[model samples]
Target: MSESKQDIMRFPPSKITDVAKALSGDLRVRILEALGDTQLSVTQLAEALGVAQPTVSINIQILEQAGLVVTAQGSNREKLCSVSCRSILLELPSRPGDGLHKTEEIRMPIGMYSLCSVQPPCGMANRDGLIIGSTDDPRAFYMPERTDAALLWFSGAGYVEYRFPNPMPPGVSIDELRLRAELCSEAPSFRMDYPSDITVFVNDLPIGTWTSPGDFGDRKGKLTPDRWTSGTEYGVLTEWSVRADGSYVNGARAAATTLERLSLKYNQPIRLRFEIREDADNRRGINLFGSAFGDHPQDIVLSFIRFKEHQEGKES
Candidate 1:
C-alpha cells in the first residue's frame, strides 16, 4: 500500500478486490504486463496479443473502466493505451476517499506518415481536382510530399477515428471543443463516378464527411517501390463538432462537445471512428499506403509511446 495526498484517503487490502477484479481477466492482465514499460495502440496491441484489433479494444475498455489502464487518441484516431502506474492507498471506507484514484501521466505516439484508398466516383485528385489521377490500377500508391501526406479511405466495416489529447492543467474549465483531420482518397472517382461521402465519428457519434473540395497532390506523383502508380483525384479538409449534434466539412460545427467531451478523466480510454456505410460511397473499396517520413531512425508512422510515474499525481 502507499500513502495518500491527505491523511484521510486510505484503502485497505480487502478493498483491493475491485482492483483485483479489474486485473482478473487474462487478456487484461497481459495488457498491463505488455505495457510494463511502453504504450501501444489497439492495432499494435492486437498484433502483439495475436488477436483482432477490436478484441484488444474490448479488453482495453474493461481495464479503463476499472482504473487499471488509460488511453489517448493517436495519429489516425487510433486508441493509444498504457497502464496506470500509481501507488495504492488504503483508507477507511467511512472516510472521504477510498481505493486509489491517483494516476501516472501517459505518453502517446506522434504522427509521422499515413495513407488511404477511397471508393470510386469520388474523383481522386490532388489538393486541387485539376490533376485527377487514375486509380484504374489497384496496385498503385501516391507519392505525395512526405511531410504533409496522410492516407484516407472508406470502409463498409468503417474506420477507427482517433482524437488528440488535450491536457487540462490542474483546474481549468473546458467549455467549447473541436475535432479536425486532414484527409484524401486513392481512386479518382469513388465508384461508377459516385462521390465517396466520408464521415467522422467520435465515441460512436456521426460528425460529417469530405466537404472542402478537389483532391490531394499536384500531378502524377513520384514512384515508390511496392506501391500503386496510377492514383485518382479527390480530397477534403474534414472537421466535426458536438455543438449542433450534426456533421460538417471544413470550418463548421458539425457536432459539439459539452462537458461529456471534457469530462474525460486522466488515465482513461476514449474512442473515435471514421465510418462509411455500405452502398454509401462510389466504388465500395478500401485502399491503403504504407509509409514513414523523417531523417530520424524511428518508424515514420508514430509508434505507441508511453510514460509512467513511480509516484501518484503530485501528492504521493
Candidate 2:
C-alpha cells in the first residue's frame, strides 16, 4: 500500500455513529469513490457525479467533518477536495465494558528543543529557506525564533534535548513509549555514501542508535516548500519504541534499556535527546527535518500508552 493508504484513521465506538451517518448518504459514497481516483474541484466533482455544484459542496462539507475527505483552496481560489484515507477501521474496546484504552500523543516542533549543544557546520532554516542567523553559530540555536525553523543540521558532534509532559495519571503506568523523527546524514551538499550514527536518549538513558544511510538531495521532497533549495532535501522517517522487554529501532532490537530501567515518574516530565557522538563509528553529522522540509509531513512525535493500576501492578 502507498504511504497515504497505510495512514489509517481509527475511530472508537463512540465516534462510530458519526462515521455511520456520514456514510449513510449515497451521494457521499459516490463522492468518495470519485475522489479515490483523483483530486477534483467542487465544479469537477459535481459534473462528474451529474449533480448540482451546491449539492456537491454540501456533501463535501459533511465528508470533511467526518474526516473522510480533505479540502483545500487551490491557486485559482477554487476548493479542491481529496480523500484523506483509503480505509477506516472501527476500534472496539479490548473487552466489553472495559472503557476506552487511553493513549496520548505529542508533536514537538523540530526546533523547539529546550537545550542544544552544537558545533561548526551547523545552521537552521525556515520553510522559505530563510536563514535564522550566521551558519555554524551555536548561539543561533538559542534564539527565540529557532522554534520557527523547519530544518536544522550540524557537523561533528552535538545534541538537542526536548522535554515532554508525562500525561500518565497518578495511578496509571506507561506500558509503551515511542518516538518518531525524520533524520539523515549531514554533508556540505549531498552525498549518498555519507553515514551517521544518530542516538536517542530518554531521561539520559540511551535507548539506541540508528545509522542514517545517507544525505539525500537528488530530488525535491514531496512536501518540501518550494523556496527551499541548495540544502538537504529529504530524509528517512525513523521510529523507535521502548517497552518493558527492550527497545527497538524500526522494529529491530537496538538496546536493552527497557521501560523499567528508565524508572519513569508521574510527577516529572520526560526528557528526550537526539545526538551524534564524536566517537561514534560514523561521524558524518546529522540533519533533522520538519513538516515543511521533509517527504513526511510530521515533526518529532511522542506517543504514550498507559495501563490500568491493576495491570501496572501485575506487570511490575
Candidate 3:
C-alpha cells in the first residue's frame, strides 16, 4: 500500500471552520485512518469497520465533498476511496506588529511561464488529463489556456521562464530566496534509469543544476487526476534556496551564487528560469508538475525572506 505523495495539506486560516467541520465526525476520522495506506471500496470499508454499506457510503460522500478523500471506479465497478492527505496545516496571516523579518510567498502555475522554447515530444495537460493542444507544437506553448496547465513535459533541451514580482519593501534587503517545485525526468513511455540535468536560473544567472534520477511511472500518483490513467504518474518535490553565503538544492550546497548576485530589490521583477541545456551531460528531458498532478500539492513556490535594519540582530 502506497500513501499519497504529499502527506500534508495546507489551508489559509479563513478555512479553519470548514476544515473543522469536515473532521468533527467520528466516522470520518475512522474512514481517514482506514484509507491511510490502501484505498478501499465502500463495501470493503463497511465490512472492515462493521458498519452498514449505506452508512459508510454516506460518510464517504461527505468526505469527498470536503476534499478529504478522492474516489474512483475500481476494476470491479465499485467506488474506491483513498485518503487525500495525511495531515493539515493552517496558515495564519501575520499581524503588523509581529516582527521585522517578513517573508513573502508566491505560487505560480506551471503553465504561466512568460517565455518557453521547447522541442518536440513536448506538451501540456490540465488536471483532467486533457491536452491543451497538439503535442510537440511550439505554438501551443503560447495558448492563452496554458494558465490552467497542471503538467508540462518536453524531450531533449528547452527552457521556461517566469517573472516574479519582488515583494521587498524599500530599504529592506533580502536575506534568503527559495524556490520549490515537483519535477522529474521525462521519457516517451517511462524509464527508471533515465537521467536529466535540470537547471535553474535567477536573473539569467545559473543558480544550480539537479540531476533527476529517472522518469517514474511505477504507480498512480496520489493526486493525479483520475482521467490520467497512463504515462508518468508523479515527480519528486525539489527545493532550491539561495542566500548571501551560497545556494543549495534540498538544503545541500550546489552553487556559490549569493543573494547579492541576484540583486533583488523593491519594484523590480525577479526572473526565474528552468532549463535543460543542450550541452548538459544528461539530455534526457524534464517534466514539471503543478498542484493538480504532482505528489506535492503546490505549484512553483517562490519565497523571499527579507531582513529589515531593525531585525538584523534577530534570527529568522
Candidate 4:
C-alpha cells in the first residue's frame, strides 16, 4: 500500500485463504487477541504466554500473512507490529438478483457517535452497553446470546445519536442511508409486526419512514452481543434505505433525510437518528439492535467499509 493510502486506510485484508487458515488455530486466535490492545515483541509475547519465541514467531507469521497483523520498523529501527485492519469486511461474489456487493460510489467517515436522552422514561444503548434499561433501572445488562435474544425490550423513546469523525475527507457525497437491527417483540414466542413503520432523522430533519421487515438470520450480524441477558426476551431486525429525501420501508414513502437535508461542511459532525413511537396496544415496547461506531447510532459500518475499500483501491 502507498504511504498516503496507508495513512488514510488503517487495515487491509491480506488474503482470504491465509486469514481463514490462520484463524483456524486456537493459538493464533490468542496471538491476535494479545495484539489487539497493544503492539508487543515476540519475546514479550513468548514470556507472557509461557511459550517459546519460535512459537510466537510462527503464529505471528501466520497472522501477518493473513492481513490480521502488520509488522513494521519501530522506533530506532526496531521491528514493530500492530493490528492492520480494524475488522474484516467481506467480499461476496455476485449472484442473480444480488445487489449487496454493488455500489455506485463510496462514502467517507465524518464523525463519532453521541447519545441524548429526552425524558426520564427513555434510555440509550450501544455495543458497549447493549441493554440500557430505564433510568430507574440504569444498570446495563448484556443481551442474551445471538440465538437466545430473539427480542430485546426497553422503555420510552429517545434518540441514540451517532457522531461521524471530524474533517470529512473528499469523496462522492453520501446519498443513501441504511439501518440494521435485531427485532422480536418482548419474547421469543411472540411475533412482531413485520416491517414496522419507523421514522429516521438526519441532523434533526425528517428524512423518511421505513417499515423494516423481520430478517431471518440469513447473514451474520456486525454487532452481536458479547453475552446474553440471564432471563429476558430479544430479536433481530437489520434495515437499510436508499431514498434520499424521505422515509421508505418496503417501497412506500414516509419520512427521512435528503442530500439537501444535510449541511455537509468539511470537518462538521454528522448525526443520524432513529425514532420509533409504539402504537397503542403494542405489547413489548421498543427492542432495537444494530451497529454503532462508538456509543451512538448511525449508518457507520456501511460508510466505514466504503472508506476502507476506497483507500485500498487507491493504493492498488
Put down candidate 2 lDDT per residue, 1-316, tens digits, no spaces: 2468558788775456567779999999999999874789999999999999999999999889878888899999999998888889986644322232455689999899989888878999987778888788988998989999899998868899999987665555677899999999999888888989999999999899999999999889887878877668999999999999999999999999999998887788899999998789998788998888879999999998655423533344
lDDT of 4 at 223: 45
lDDT of 1 by residue, 154-173 (tens): 33333434443434332322
**Could you tell me how far off, in angstroms, the CA of residue 284 lies in candidate 3 after the best superposition?**
1.4
Q: Which residue pairs in candidate 2 collide? A: none
Sorted on lDDT, best first, the list reads 2, 3, 4, 1
By TM-score, the better pick of 2 and 4 is 2
Name the candidate, 1 or 2, with the larger TM-score value: 2
Model 2's alpha-carbon lDDT is 0.85
TM-score of candidate 2 versus the correct structure, residues matched by position: 0.70
- Name the 10 consecutive residues with the lowest summed lDDT in model 2: 93-102
Tell me how far the alpha carbon of residue 186 in candidate 2 is from the true structure, in angstroms, after superposition: 0.6
Give candidate 3 regions above 4 Å deviation: 1-101, 306-316
lDDT of each: 0.44, 0.85, 0.85, 0.47
Superposition-based RMSD of candidate 4 using all C-alpha atoms, in angstroms = 13.4
Tell me, by TM-score, which candidate is best.
Answer: 2
Better of 1 and 4 by TM-score: 4
Name the best candidate (by lDDT). 2
Q: What would you estimate as the lDDT of candidate 4?
A: 0.47
